[model samples]
Target chain A: MAQKVVEEAVVAVTEPAVLIHRIALLFSPGRHWLLLILASLPAFSLFATVLPEDRADVMYHRYDGGGVEVDGPSILVRKSVMDTVSLSANYYVDSISSASVDVVSTASPYTEERTETSLSMDYLHNKTLMSLALTKSDESDYLSETGSFSISHDMFGDLTTVSLGYSVGNDDISRNGDADFGDQVKRQNYRLSLSQILTKNTILGVGWETITDEGFLNNPYRSYRYLDPLAGNGYSYLPEVYPRTRTSNALALRLKYYLPYRAALSSEYRYFNDTWGVDANNFELAYTHPFKEKWIFDIRYRYYTQDGADFYSDLFTRRAPQTYLARDKELSSFQSHTLGLAMSYEIKPGFLQFVDRGTLNLAYDYIHFDYDDFRDLTRGGVVGEEPFYSFSANVIKAYVSIWY
Target chain B: MLTNHRLLPLVLLLALTGCAIEPWVQPYERARLADPIMSFERDPVANGFRHHVYQTREAARGAEGGGGGGCGCN
Candidate 1:
């Protein structure tokens, strides 16, 4: 019943995004090894090639008619003191020549040229609200560094607001591919927030986050080969967890409603627990309306579920596999559902200046990832060894922000 | 791991759904107004390019503000 084997594996992956709409026939090598096994990991090992001057994945795959051509360069600055303090800065840069991460398997997809940078500061007294930030990510494969701070108050006036924050990130990955889910990982997070309004229309937020992770969180370039006749290659070899350490806790809730003028309604829910034996829950919804005055409308829906990672295994393991390294994909702990539609058009092209503003946004998204413990690990290859590989993506973006 | 303590009475009964919102009190939102809503909507590089488009499609990321990217994925 796993939803009819995940709708027969997404009707068998919608016959290739509607079967060849052409982006050079959708760059295959197993769709670039499924986008290099989902963009080969490595975030806090600080893999730098000078990338981070603004690279929103090249601005959401920036203006494409296909056949791949992307260009992105971004920068931002903000300040408005007088009542208090506020300062901000952002920079992004990207240069990708995409061969889908230089195809050599182990989940390929990490074709260099990257840069990311971030800085932020905020301080406001009396009622309290504080912030400090820093981020740097450069990539040829991976590199990361992050710092964060936050504070908030207003608890006990019935309008409730409380926040406490912390962040630390470190990354290093790039020994050139072969990531079966091991290649360096370090993370630290602590957060607590509460926002309450309770009546005039429902505004609520609750959050508690705690994360402590240590070293090479796994993905050493990736691998999965099974050909067993009695371990003759029935597969089973994934040794390396790089000083693995994990602890996670999260509980989140958010709600918002307003039905006029800028019509709004929002929802969010999250629950998570971790220590290798992963468990996750996420739900989200959004509706934004603003038409005519520059037209704007947005709609969104999301749901995610997880449960897999006490060294999730598949390829027939009953007892001789306790995560001697794990990376068996079905995207581990499966369940992904998403539906989205967005539109934004705010133009102030009055020959620039007047606080130069311009925005154009269009989005369409549909996602489905489900695996009922797929378990097959290929023997005669019926696309099953736990077959469930479905992916669909679409994005369009436009930007213009000028403030001098 | 279960000191969600019955999640504090379901988070105080969902914090009574935080009574809805529409409180626009500016005069610089007083108290000097620093980071009012995460640095008053700081726009972390447009929310880090909307979080690199929600890590590759599928949308929805708290309209700018609070938390960001981390992956060991799974």
Candidate 2:
């Protein structure tokens, strides 16, 4: 179900937090090693660099799954000034309609829309590049603003690149019908990455990121069921509660190899862990093939698995059973498999006089997700003995790009 | 913490030595790498949308060189 669709008039009265702002965890002792690594990177080398191409893209995307439908349009444009600076802007919108299980269980089916706008500027100096970006997203009851900065330098005679980045986000949450309900969440992210050209035909990249969030971390409109023998259905619903703060870390390794012929192969592995007692792994492989001079084809497969959070459960024993409680399926143990295919065709220059190059692209993906702890309650089976839940989704993207 | 201190000198030594190492793959030999087929991310718009989809559905996020977080999806 789309989290953006919440038409309920229910009042979400958030209680006082058991803990105060834990934003200080960003500088915890455990992060010293990462800081030292960043400090020890080599100085930049004097190498010539050019700005990225000036281009514009128009894309339409759709996702259909779990009785929810979402379709959106995204437009991005970038331009270069002189030879040192590149500026870009993006406008994105998502229109959502949902009648998923979560909505059918305790809330009414709803429709909603969210829009996001972002702008960024990149400056290239010698072999070093600096970038700054700002983004804002607005929905009926939620608003978020984020700002980010990053720097990259080419070292070791252009054989290696090192980058550091940081971003912060502030968000405001409000209830639809309750004018008095308001909450805020603050988030910070730290990133470090390296890209190395191992050989003429091979490249490798590694990245690590730490993200910390403090404040309201749960869905205000969602509820969890607890066993209540006194009730007719043997259960009662209460607003879901969650920890006030969360911290997560992710590390990823990627490799791309150019085949001897006219093909490229890529593989990636990522590991993730969080303070909420969740661990995850993701693996992916992809291949790209170019035919003649005007067409390219791509195929990819991905697998992901994760363990449930410590407080996640299908059904709780009683009300206020634990300090933190959640039945959100996203926090449950699950695995997913994805298969994707894409094709792109280059447009002849004679077709468009002003544009230097153009391409039309189409892509599709099919994903299957299986949950280990979350169950399908609509089956009308015994409580705690219901069958596990699984679903499949189809995603499509069609886009056009032009370079001038 | 003491172990990190001891290892710092070794790391510094290794990085300093990098300057002396010659480029193994010459610029002329990078033709294959320059090809569009070898790009890690070919379509930025499509790739960005894919990332958003997964981030909204899964508990795992970040470490993919993406920034800006204003998604109400999750």
Candidate 3:
């Protein structure tokens, strides 16, 4: 049962890719011409703008916890090419240093860097909007390429909206230390969403997603341990094994309410289940308020819990391992909490000659995780004496955005 | 799968209720809804970064639409 859930989890994570592809394919040259023609029509002129807007954003992020540290910077730029068309590009980088328990117990800690680049285009034709995006990520031992497309339509005087999307991705996986090890994985995703304005102060949305994955799903460098009675209570490590294919589904509902005091409240609930025995739920709440005509303050909280995969175990008792086994802590039963706060200040227009609007934002979040079944392996091999795995992490983000 | 069977009815119920209770508001009376703060995503860049952080850390993904690639972090 756990194996089924694990498979589903892997597939579920890959669903976003499929929807992207579908949306991209939806906009061929003929459709683009048609949309352009529609945009120029006098009937639609009232809903379109004549001037283009340009914006740039720069962000920095840092994460520290569980003997692992990651810090990075990202930059994004967007420009409107036409009244109904816009383009955007982003570059992101991550520098990671890890001395986590798993690495210390079985392997040496190391530093690595990953970089990603992406480009996207969006088009709006009257009440219909469409988008296409492509992304590439590269590291020393891994590479991935992904494409996505999506479309949304507004109806009933713009009180309701529906969207559909698809994406696809291909990834090449390898281990730096093991030159001979190489594998690949393919992922696809499909998504549908509906949004409605319930009243002047309230809006609600619901979304459903499905994902499919094929090929290698396990970490090439990760291993699990099993006790060997013949070795006098000691344990031996073996490479983790996983199924090659998986499918999973997820559903989410979100709500936003505007308060009379100029504050906004938002909440979301998500439920996920997979073929492996895993079931998960997530709940989130947020509040945003504006003050002094220049500052916005926001606070959010999230709770997440999940069941373990069927084959996930901290220690295998048998001398011979099962055909498919894994001990990755993420596949274990766990619960986590996150609390976040953010503040953004807007600069008044005309503060700069060329810049129309500018905003500076800073945000921070603290996350805590507790594993119910997985244990910290840094301790000596003792069954009941092993401590349950738990860790806390902090994340910080600072960014500035400017529009011209 | 059985859990999905049970939740499907609830989802349908809520969706229907949302559609049924939607009140019509004239274009001139939509000032509140048009407020920047009322937008589902007021800042695309910030929201994208937030989504990436959550996707990499959590086991679940895909509530939002696509455009993210896989990394070895998971």
Candidate 4:
């Protein structure tokens, strides 16, 4: 009888040991263990409690640390595609004041204020994402807008993917009572991309983009200060001219690296060139780090630079009329840099504690812009110029979300 | 005044489009599929950022890939 009892105890210990070994084999240490547990909970529960599809996301942004200011609010909602295809749209209204483009001509340096709203949507499938998106903005100084459609397909057992999409739209600038002569633009774009899974933990992709635009292409709102043709004002601009047609081609590549436990590193670069003698380069990098339990953090940096169009010229140019085709900003090269940080934390949901999808997110981004000195040939002094001034703006966004 | 107002419909059209489609991934799936830093998520944000930058610096429109729709510029 004593021997029998010993054998039964051995069996009980051996069975649990086997089970533990199996679990460890499937879940590698560091982060996979946690993921397995988190991913398995829903699997074991078999979604006993479905999370509410209703969620609220909002972005309240304020820009400029000084006399120039901007404030706006935006929000988002997500519906389940499994049920009725998900939809999300955001709107924003902003008030502004600055040294630039004040339609009120009040000399207050703060007369320009505007409202802007943008909406985006997705027709979702289990494995495909088809979306049509649009954005529009109205301000005291100028009105700008665009609409687009994008599609993403998951292939190779969700490892490899392909995307093809297109967009067409226009940006019109107006103030007081007149549209910028030749300022209207009609355009269309085409895109093709290929994404490949380099490893279980890595993905790399390449893309091509093309755009063609024709029609009124003038910035009636802005001008190079020249002697007024009609009156002898200190500075007056000759009428701006529109380029009848323009085209652009861009190539881009992206890479993503997966680390332990939902952590990742991502980067991308793009090069663009146009028929009008303009060239641009873009580079971006970001890192994602997830803490124990349910907290995620993100840090990102971006750099961009673009050469001016051949037709571009500034306040004073030594070049003859042959070199000056008549667009103001087109002559000035431009560059920009951005830094961003964001975080998400999960906590108990008070209203629907029974369901398991609850998390809150906060994000902030800041950017700086400047125009480079490809300046005047005769007036050697970039001395009197501010080097295209500096613009700084920050936007903060917050969101509450749930998943089933 | 009427010509100036043509932009009004364009702005309204964009705001309306916001309701038609959404980012490929839903809010909840953001963590799993569309982390903010990922290319998929960053594309749209960068698209907007680039536009803003181009508007401020170079000529607003380029030779090739631009408009997201069929309508042409004025």
Over the stretch A1-404, how does candidate 2's per-residue lDDT look in tens digits? 11211111010001001000111122245544432432243431112233555789999999999878999999999888866789999999889998877777778888888898989999988778898989888888889888988888887767788889888989899878889989999988888988888998898989999889998988888888889999887888898899999999999999999988879999999999999998999999999988888999999999999998999988999998998988888889999999999999998568678787789999999999999998888777888888898999999999999887
TM-score ranking from best candidate downward: 2, 3, 4, 1
Candidate 3: which stretches are off by over 4 Å? A1-54, A349-352, B1-23, B65-73
Chain B TM-score against the true chain B, each candidate:
0.24, 0.63, 0.55, 0.25
lDDT of 2 at A108: 85
lDDT of 1 by residue, B1-74 (tens): 55778789878876885443334431112111111121212233444554564543221222223545342222
State in Å the error of residue A281, model 2. 0.5
Off by over 4 Å in 1: A1-205, A208-227, A230-271, A274-311, A314-353, A356-400, B1-31, B34-40, B48-74
Q: After superposition, how far is residue A13 of candidate 1 from its true place, in Å?
A: 51
- Candidate 4 local lDDT, A1-404, one digit each (tens): 33443343333222222222233233334434343333333211111112113344555555553245655555555454454255656555555556542211213354555555556666645456677777676754456677878777664334456778887767665556644432456677788777765654566778887888776555455444433345433334455554678788888888887766667888878888888788888888989888885887888898878888777655544223543455454445877787988887877776876444556777777877676643332223333352343455665555555542
Off by over 4 Å in 4: A1-55, A65-68, A81-84, A101-121, A124-127, A134-147, A170-173, A179-183, A226-236, A260-262, A318-331, A352-359, A374-395, A398-404, B1-39, B42-74
The predicted structure with the larger lDDT, 2 or 4, is 2
Error of 1 at A39 (Å): 54
CA-only RMSD, every prediction: 25.0, 14.7, 12.7, 14.2
Q: Candidates' TM-scores? A: 0.26, 0.86, 0.82, 0.66
lDDT, residue A23, candidate 2: 16
- The candidate with the higher DockQ, 2 or 3, is 2
Local distance difference test, each candidate: 0.51, 0.79, 0.74, 0.54
